[model samples]
Target chain A: TQLLEQSPQFLSIQEGENLTVYCNSSSVFSSLQWYRQEPGEGPVLLVTVVTGGEVKKLKRLTFQFGDARKDSSLHITAAQPGDTGLYLCAGTQTGANNLFFGTGTRLTVIP
Target chain B: DAGITQSPRHKVTETGTPVTLRCHQTENHRYMYWYRQDPGHGLRLIHYSYGVKDTDKGEVSDGYSVSRSKTEDFLLTLESATSSQTSVYFCAISELDNTEAFFGQGTRLTVV
Candidate 1:
């Protein structure tokens, strides 16, 4: 099993604060994806990083894949109250489409 | 918003009873997956179907079974429900195995 571990299981920050969430794994993956889920809703895809050491930005969110494809990080600049939700990192193995999801990071941005 | 829907949005059943959840898709995607979400665990894949009548087990498939008879429908069954099986279930679809998946709203199951 490819285990993905996420640090800072929970984060509470003020609006406009900057924060980063990390996902680490010992097994390498071909691609990694970030998803955001709110209460009573399914997870929504944020970004997918395929190449190693790649970075993608979506508005205030910046996602980066590790050089070895075994880790990833998501950084939010000037977080807003609407950013309060659960962030999950999922990795797809080199030859598989089944995604392994990390434990998750619950972020609460107080306005 | 990929036109995915799950039936019985909320269900409550006694342990040992059989329960089935249905997923319907309008996009005619070839891949369909069943997942269960708990508090600490993000989401566990129960089963997945590559095509009609072609299914495979996932990481967490022991207690669950799935069947897809038509192109647009996938059903997940819990042969004998248990309290531990109480969780929110989500169904997702994708055109390709490695593509972005579209998820249904989800079904909340409660096994007493």
Candidate 2:
């Protein structure tokens, strides 16, 4: 069973548009990370969030950890064609070493 | 990009045959993991190793076994291949918990 769930399994948008993807779980997490995967390649790490309600920005990409530590969100502003890929969220629960990955969101940005 | 490499990027085998996938890392990271990706199921952990000769089973361990005889190498074996096992397998390595994981390009396996 998948411990984490992600919303908007698929998204398609034009260039300069905005989009948000969500990852949620019932179990609390100690830390959560975001990754982006392109075709024929492995997922690359984007950012890691450790604090609840804390937000981090990577250029036009913004990531936020839920205040309850059971959810997270990723927002991309001015989406570009280069932003098209699969977005994944992984979390490590307290006292656990195995990383539980969430269902992925595939984003397609058309130019 | 993190000096992690997976061999046999693509493979096709018949059912009931045995296959092994190799994951090699030059970074000497302590943690290595094997994951299989399928539609809707996302990425499911098959097995993982924390050090040489120290390994553990993950969520989907059926018909799968792993060996880590050396720090730089982790191997996953399928005793007998099946059509249900066909999926893209990924290798990930990390030096510590709560840190970034470096993944290999992934191996596309097909069982016919």
Candidate achieving the largest DockQ: 2
The Cα error of candidate 2 at residue B69, in Å, is 0.9
lDDT of 2 by residue, A4-70 (tens): 9998999999999999999999999999999999999998999999999989999999999999999
The alpha-carbon deviation from the true structure for residue A42 of candidate 2, after best TM-score superposition, in angstroms, is 0.6
**For every model shown, what is its TM-score relative to the native structure?**
0.98, 0.98
The whole-model lDDT of each prediction reads 0.93, 0.94
Residue A65's lDDT within candidate 2 is 100
With candidate 2 superimposed using the best TM-score fit, by how many Å does residue B55's alpha carbon deviate from the native?
A: 0.1
Instruction: Estimate, for each residue in B1-112, the C-alpha lDDT of model 2 and write its tens digit.
Output: 7998898999999999999999999999999999999999888889999889999888899999999999999999999999999999999999985478999999999999
Stretches of candidate 1 above 4 Å error? none
Using Cα atoms, each model's DockQ against the true complex is 0.66, 0.80
Question: lDDT for model 2, on a 0 to 1 scale?
Answer: 0.94
lDDT score of residue B44 within candidate 1: 84
Q: Candidate 2, TM-score vs. the true structure? A: 0.98
